[model samples]
Target: MTITRRDFLNGTALTIAAGLAPTSVLRAAEAQGPAYPPALTGLRGNHPGTFTLAHSLAREGAKYPGVLARESYDLVVVGGGIGGLAAAWFYQQRFGGNARILILDNHDDFGGHAKRNEFTVRGRTLVTYGGSAEMPPSANDNAAVRALLAGLDLAPRIQARPGDDYARRGLGRAVFFDAEHFGRDQWLAGDPFAALVDARNAGVRPAPEDLGAFLNAAPLPPADRQALQRLAQGETDYLSGMAGEARARYAQSTRYAVFLREKAGLGLPGLRFLRSRSQDAYALDADGITVAQAISIGLPAGAGMAAPAIDPRLGKSPASRLWFPDGNATLARALASKLVPGVAAAQGQEIVGARFDYSKLDREGNPVRIRLNSTAIAIEPDVRITRVTYGWQGNLQRVEAAHVVVAGYDMMVPFILPSLPVPAKAALRACVKAPLVYTKVALDNWRAFDALKTWRIHAPTMAYSDLWLESAPGGKDDPVVLHMLYVPTVPDSGMSARERFRAGRAFLLGTPFEVLERDIRAQLDRMLAAGGFKSARDIQGITVNRWAHGYSYMPSGLAPDDANLQVALEQAGRGVGNIRIAGADTAGSPSVTAAIEQSMRAVGSLNPKT
Candidate 1:
């Protein structure tokens, strides 16, 4: 069965069209009523109409000439993502609760990458994370993040109950070897990585008996199968002589793919099988991550070598992470509610089901206002006040602020604030973001997964590298949301990490939604057909959260360790006069804690007392 664009658009025609249609048409569409963004389906994240002005100004140096209105605020924040919202929150704490703050974001929704996707099927409301899913345990340890969570009265809820209906039904993990990569369509009953990681973390080597049957059933060559069996059995020491810090350094510095081939004696097919193993976490392939970096993030390590100690600051396992049904988007909503009380009245877990009043977000006379569908194009600093120019509703509007906090992507800062020093701009340009897609597909039922006894499947070579069911208390007959991940990487292309990221961004932007939708349907059909799955019938709706610029680029062993580049990155976050930069990029990490901490630091820099 073939699904069409019309099938996905339950009632989101206006939202989907708003991005593609002309300004005149868009204006007419907005005249109907305020848009409730969470409920809108189809293509999301970096949706159309969001980045047109940004591209125009950055790429073509196009100027917006019209100045429709001029307003003033105590603080102005560019980019209304988590960082921007936190900046506003911190400004209130520092400068008092009455500080007038204006937050401008290009997307119709706030939260930046922390987006929420909602669907209604058979009178049941299903929620899924479109982007920025979890708050790691490390985030809770931060004083600022803890304070923010407390202020919002947000606490983690038990994600899975004692008797999860899906679990009780015996669903587990599996792997799908597609015909294109494995020479035949094959579905294995267990995930080798999951079993191996669990075994390694528990200080036990995985026995061949545990994975032998699964590997033998896989459509892999004999050499590749033997290599995997050896990896599981923990028979060979990849780093035979090295130990302690020396071994750690070597693992941290060497590429994982290289380690597999040269050190572990794995063949080309085995390397391809593991290419996308790291995509879900780092949005990079084996080539982009080092062996130590892979192990730190809980990827399966070679069994013979002692597992490296995991850095507490880095990502932990999913069991330790906490999130609401809509993921960190609930945190965004909570932040918004705290800023503008009219947005939402719910607290804690109730916020998960809260229906934010979009109309109340930007009401006049509010201490804090979040203005959506407004893209900041220029920041002209003056002696007393800085003027921020933005495009809103096909018109250029100007706002003046005593202090300006730029909380958008670091790479785009150079384009927005061209007056920065040469080195500072160069530093900002070096912060390249990885591109990824989080597609949330609403299915009428999860019978296919139930029948297959697998709720998650890792498809390394497919258009989407991973697919899993959301952790909700749903039986096989109930409607459920399936989350799919796609990280665009051009491996072995001889391009640097930054170059590869740019190419991936282009691919995400240039590809049409229809093409993406087709691939999603085809892949799901192929992987689930044996379990009596029919994509066109089972799929109720699809929302592709395409983030051309997704994760902040954190330096890894793949890149040359250059001190000058590190110095430049540090200088980039330093404020010039009244302008400050804050975001996950500023901290060189993609966690929510980084976003909040950087915002707090940016706000603290503006303290008059210091």
Candidate 2:
């Protein structure tokens, strides 16, 4: 089971033509843990069930034989997130009318975490307020976003903002806390030497203060340095870096894990934090270090018979440099308005284009269809899916898709994709820092708020999450809105529907009344303050944008190595011939950029007619 890069390449070449040649090397991989690259293996699984459902639904067909008749479509999209929407958009934009795409979301609307805020103000009949916000400044560089802009003819509108390594590579949130309270900026702007002296005097040792302190403490073996460089030269040559079984693990891993197993290659002071139970969530913040120190950390550690070939940093690292526009939601609102006018229709009476049933809406007015109502039920093989099936309200509905585009952790995918046949890259399944949830608060002082407006800022909380959306053109009086995320309760894992609803309500009704509210208010208070309007009655209305669960979990050190994994993930991207996946799970880590990239990739390759 000691797989070398040579063996993988041989297997890859052989597997590529399994439809034409015998993949002996591919067989060796199959015998182990990795899910056989479908393009290489012909083993399809599923013991035919009683076929009861088919028969039962067929009974309806007998009564009305043509009732649930299957309809042929150029594409049958299984999931409807930004990725799917982008795919549909790209397909039409690239190959137009010929590809009759049918996007199916168990939910009513699209845009995964891109759900929004709805507000109402008294003495003001118009709702000139609402918008989507809180995104990585790197989105401007996102291939998918660029493709989308090109598709929509707004590429020029995307102002060219230079980005930090982290921003361009699309990793890490530009995490900012109340600098005045946390002294973050004082620490950031103050000389690194001065801050280092302060922390050192305060007895904060072993904590990374400067490049030298970090290097001095890192556990890199001098002998391994040469080999580590070799790995960085080419993933194909990286295995030579690890001593023993470590080299073998790289050959069999699901691309991401090898990074966990191989980072020992860095012969400097690089540390890994165990953020989750999975073996893969280890991270290395190698900024301010030499290029060599950064590259040394990219090799895979042996995980049984698996190893992924990865170069520590593929694009760039997250540094002090970053980028953002007037507000990050510019594209989200611009596109959401174009795609789901139903979102605008739900904005009271001002916007009048598409109409949606308000009663069928979530408390936030986001249509019911887009919400993931149930806890993850099952993930199966063949198509490797997370299946959340329901018979609630006397309706049979299911959210079935190949990959979950899990931006949180690998374990999340397993929780939903119970039957996932791929190597349970447990290391890759772990989540990073708790995702920050955002929402906006509005104060109505008996004034007519603009019902439709542009983006706004909460200035106090440094919460740029608030914005004004124009559901319908020419409507004035946008409502007062507060866009925010910074939820104190976004636990490591996901929550059930019951948990989501209660948590959401606590954020709304409990504010100024709830305990967490006091803590948050203290922070926002530092940024903004208004006391005259006291009671909730004095307040006409409020809107919140809650990503109880935010997009995929992305941290440092999550680039794939083995080419085979890329192949497995790539194959998983396609859907029912025309149907395909569009999210962070494919392409690379969880980010709007990757989501857009994968969507465009799938869109270009789609033969919806098939």
Candidate 3:
């Protein structure tokens, strides 16, 4: 018999009550009192609240095909993206031939937004479009992600460079920071602890510090100033070190940023600043908790942290985390490679993945087998799926004993279930997610102006949101620059700052060319005139892709912001069954961790781990 959500949790509770386990984690949880989840509440800042949480994190393009027939198997993975691929790959590795897996997707390829656009820009070849922009990471805390990299054997190939290195190459050493608000290097390089010590030693003093007096001074609201002052002094570690808001912020920030930037961005330089210094799911969503939760669960598992500014980077904040090469893209690619051979090699425009093999099974008594381009229509009795009538595609498909592991955008959840029972529908529907938008940009310039080595996130001069993306990551002589942006979308008429992004069309782009050709020409007039290529005319080809819901949101909420979402996933089989979920959106942690988590979650549906 299939285990329901209630059954699963109750079983867990019983298992704990039996005291057969060897760990005291539960007792510790109880003794520590009510703890904060640190995934969301840990990081409190203004953000775009557009993403919804009712489903998994993956996109089922608008042209999704309708289920044309009925067929059953060990698994029926609706989406063929990274999350699903990860689950399938891991299952294959751990269980081998023990489990049969079948992956179904509406798109022509398997990688989803990870598609690449290669073309000659100013006569240079580039991995132009779609997918990650950079490897936004800090240090050690990325165990699961690194483990995946180790499995790939591509860990050493990772290229690590500083943000400024990219900027200097592009700007001719003219890299600039805000003139006011914060000091030139204080925001990125200052150490608050060191400064404090120096200031206290009778006659000694630390020079070249502006954020100090300004941030700590009574210039703005008390709360803002308090955090700002701590940040200015580099005492942020105190928050997390002693089980305070800072630690919670650090965990939440690291988790959210690593997930979005490293795992999701995967070599992408998007998301100018993460909300907290956190590095896990708790950073994304605080769930419902109080000051006590903020202290206990939010902080690290050790002695209280030292004073701020003492090698702040080394103080255990989340932003200072390290990363692996290829980020999570390598993992996605590896997973995709396992599911579909041709799919792995063809992640770009030239048509990846194997050609459509089998047809959908349109009638009963048909042998279950693999089929391509088959859309899910609905699920009846919360178990049986019924394919919808579409433009006569062909015979129904069924893969005997095929198992599925889906990991993609959560919004596709509704469609994943071919049909749904009224009760399960309400529960799944209640797991609402915040709205989100993922946008990326790639540009090739005729002339090679410096500043490629240094990375920066300064907003455009005007009319748009402030520059929220990290600096570009290329050397001045790199010949091309790629930039990605994380723009949040607000709904209807709202007074929120995100209203600006909502005004524009949503695009999950990885284009090969920047539309601001005129701007490029102007910036490189001298270089273009000297380098042979004059204007946009000399530029070559370009490609781009867009997703309305590229990434999911990590709003502040109950324990582990995604707790409710996790609960919602239990009803995967109750929908129309047409929605196929995947992506970081559906992830409980919303990072590589969550991506990994949801994939396993999907697997438990088809084949229990134990």
What clash count goes with each model?
0, 58, 140
| Top candidate by lDDT | 1
lDDT per residue as tens, model 3, 1-610 = 1112333334323211232121221121121101211111110111111121111112212222233344445455555555666656556556664355565544333444444333444565443224432333331244544554455443433344334444344432111122222222222222232233334322333342554453343223445444434433333333333356665555433333233333223111112221211212121121112222222222221124322221111111222222322233444455544444433234322222222221221123322222223333332222333232211132223332333334544434445443455544444443333322222223454133232222333221111112122233343333443332333322112222122112222221111124323333443332224334444543343222334333334333323434464455545432333223444554333344555545654454443422
Where does candidate 2 have its weakest 10-residue lDDT segment? 38-47
Candidate 1 lDDT trough over 10 residues, lowest sum: 1-10
Evaluation by lDDT, superior candidate among 1 and 3: 1
Q: What RMSD does each model have against the real structure?
A: 5.3, 17.7, 16.1
Candidate 1 clashing pairs?
none
The TM-score of candidate 1 is 0.91
Query: What TM-score does structure 3 among the candidates reach?
Result: 0.52
Q: What would the TM-scores of all predictions be?
A: 0.91, 0.43, 0.52
Q: On a 0 to 100 scale, what is the lDDT of residue 162 in model 2?
A: 25
What lDDT does each candidate get? 0.78, 0.33, 0.33
Candidate 1: count of backbone clashes, pairs at least 3 residues apart or interchain = 0
For model 1, residues 192-257, the per-residue Cα lDDT tens digits are 667676666666656667677777787878888888777767666767777678887778678888
